[model samples]
Target: MQEIFSAILGDQLGPFGPLILMGTLGAVLILFTLPVLLKKKQDPLDRLRDQIKTSKDVANGKAPARLRYDNQKGARLEKYSAFLEPQDEEEYSAAQLKMIQAGYRSKNAVRMFHFAQFAMGLGALALGLIYALLKSAQQDMSPKSLVLTVLLPGVIGYMAPKYWVTRRIEARKEEIVNGFPDSLDLMLVCVEAGQSLDQAIIRVAVEIRAGFPALADEYEIVSHEIKAGKDKSVVLKDMAERCGVPDVASFVTVLIQSQQFGTSIADALRIYAAEMRDKRVMRAEEAANKLPTKMTLATMMLTVPPLLIILIGPSVYDIYTLLNETNF
Candidate 1:
């Protein structure tokens, strides 16, 4: 039976084959989301009927209701989330902020994140089991190889969520850095039009919501924080920190200084706006300068080798044929 099992599962497919198989299993587990999403999505007609029902209730002086969610699913998620919750206060806050930076900020976002982390760890372990079994069959089925193969992927699976979240934070920070100059320009225009800084932020958020939503969301949050009795300078500083943009930090600094010294905000904003525009232009020129060097490397990798082969192969073949005809 062991021989039969080994023969069927252990065909040699090179060093990368087991790894590819494990990756395929991980990908298959990810597809579980498709069924959940498809199941939860209501038909257009069903949604329309729900909307009509809510409208009629509002017309009849009754409160309109929100869509019903599955309590059992929520409970299960919360349970799994608690299983993976961070123990340290700082770690918990950092995790929450990372999720927010990744554009998840609902009340349940933290819970959902922890749940996903748990799911991925289990999925990785299962994939590692199959990979380990396959590898053991193909080669020496030792305890050490089994332990090494299973343990490595299991550890990677446990840390994958953190890695993905870190990537999202960096990507979000880059967007803020790239789009912030325009957002600053828009807010400057609003400030010059005699709007208060708070009002300017609100207006800018509306204006740039489609083009620069990440920055707009920060602005929107600032507006809400101010309305909710937070100090404007503190909120602005917090936003800059959360965005992780040096330009935004400088912009916030100027705004805070202007407010403190009773300076003309319009003047302050105008000067900063010009500086941001110049910085953006310089960044573009720098990227353009690097393009040629990058393309040179790409040409060497993708073009030069092919050309060399094409130019040399026919001559080499001709020389061989000539030598053969001369009976050399």
Candidate 2:
């Protein structure tokens, strides 16, 4: 087998040709076989239905079965969590909060996140070292180049999970912002229709779910928390913290103050909902106002040059022709 691989790849890969070929073939085999080995017995449709049912259960004041099972799964991670998770309380809390904001409320999410970073960094570092060794065997490599090649992948791999989490947080924030106005309008309607605040939230969650699932999910969680006999103020504050949106924080403040001062909740919702709509419109206008500035460079780069060339080409061509004729 070594001789066969050497005969096939020795010219391109040098002395390590057989070893590299076997390693590559082994990786490919794992890629193909791992999914089969890990295949689950549950049908995909059933899994999706289960998720939907879990949401419905929460909305109806029942504890989600999925969450109960997740607690059990979380216990498995707890055994090694000290190794997998950050030891600093502040750092761990910050990471957990980020995970929550990114819509991952699982107890094991932070543990899994740190574990992923470690696994990816270790794997990438190994691959990088192997590649550097292969390259060094093929050609002379400076120590600096070798160091860079080995460390760059490891650094990038370690940070990739954090980057993904940041992107998720941004995307979730944008979705919440876009949907908040609509949800507020729906809540306002529910409130005006004589439903209590808690009922209004549940209704709004169900009604706006098709269009704005993230915001709806937040509302659903609030409803579930409220149903569990938690203090309404604390639940609202928790929702704001989980959302990390200024608009939501303000809304929570409004609700809290209204309750404190004996103001009508319906009136508060009505006023705040209108303000939210205005804010949404203002955001749209602000984006539109910046459009011209954003497009100015693109317009010049793409349109002005072509126009200039079209206008001057014939004149330049005529001048060149006249100069040539005069010389002739």
Candidate 3:
């Protein structure tokens, strides 16, 4: 065990071991991130649509070898999805909804998340053990510190994937909230141009890709559902739930009311768009108003010490010099 730890920490295997470890890690990171970096930013719905199309091609025996391999990986992930998910129907459905809101609507996404959590936990535990072993050989550390070094990282690693997913959900919501009004404006324009609500939505989805891809993608899904003969209110409600945003839910509620009451849909959208823009401006102003408080600590850390030294440093220096002269 000591020898293994030494080799892992590069004491026995020497510099070459660390070099190899870093190289392997770099390669793994590159492999994981390269495809993501290379692909143009696309909406999740659009990506899913493409994935569905690819699956259809494979079913028809027209997919390439690469696509076949991709499909196999997806299937393999799906097999493990049940392990991450609860067996209880109610709890599983809730967890699934949370995953969807986090832009993880792919069937295998939760499985992949669980896999990542396990991998990270094991890796952290291994690294922590290696660290503890190496340090114990070189110094007399306390048992408490050793235990903490090993267990803390293991716990954090296990939780990291879930934390990251939560952050993704928050970021997705923020993006949707920020871009929603512009999308509404575009939809309003289309509606005023004599397009039906469904047609207007499709147009807005196409037009808003550059500015707000996520919202545009949701709109695209709405269009597809409508075309598939789903009730607008039901589909829009689904979108609101999937997004998990109060603003979107309220907007959908407005649309449903307009439809139910046979009100002027275009006028309703125009008025709602104005309200959204105002709300966005208010949010911005609120953030701006809080900037000074947020900056206070940083300002003190950077500026206060220098000001104190400038004010009192010279007097202390003078006193030291005088006392030295008097031999006090």
TM-scores for the candidates: 0.68, 0.74, 0.74
Off by over 4 Å in 3: 1-71, 77-82, 137-141, 325-328
- The residue-by-residue lDDT of candidate 1 on 177-229, one tens digit each, is 88888887888888878899899999999988887788889999999999999
| Model 1 clashing-pair count | 0
TM-score of 3: 0.74
Model 2: residue 294 alpha-carbon error in angstroms: 0.9
Of candidate 2, the 10-residue stretch with the lowest lDDT total is 64-73
lDDT tens digits, residues 76-138, model 2? 656666677889999999989999999898878999898789778868866886887679667
Q: In model 2, state the lDDT of residue 279.
A: 95
Off by over 4 Å in 2: 1-76, 311-328
Candidates' C-alpha lDDT? 0.79, 0.86, 0.82
Question: What's the lDDT of the predicted structure labeled candidate 2?
Answer: 0.86
Worst 10 residues of 3 by lDDT: 12-21
Clash pairs (backbone) in predicted model 1: none
Q: Could you tell me the lDDT of residue 185 within candidate 3? A: 89
157-252 per-residue lDDT for model 3 (tens digits): 999998998998999999999999898988899999999999999999999899878888898899999999999899999999998889999999
Sum up the clashes in candidate 2.
0
Pick out the ten consecutive residues of candidate 1 with the lowest summed lDDT: 33-42
For all the candidates, what are their Cα RMSDs to the real structure? 11.8, 10.7, 10.9
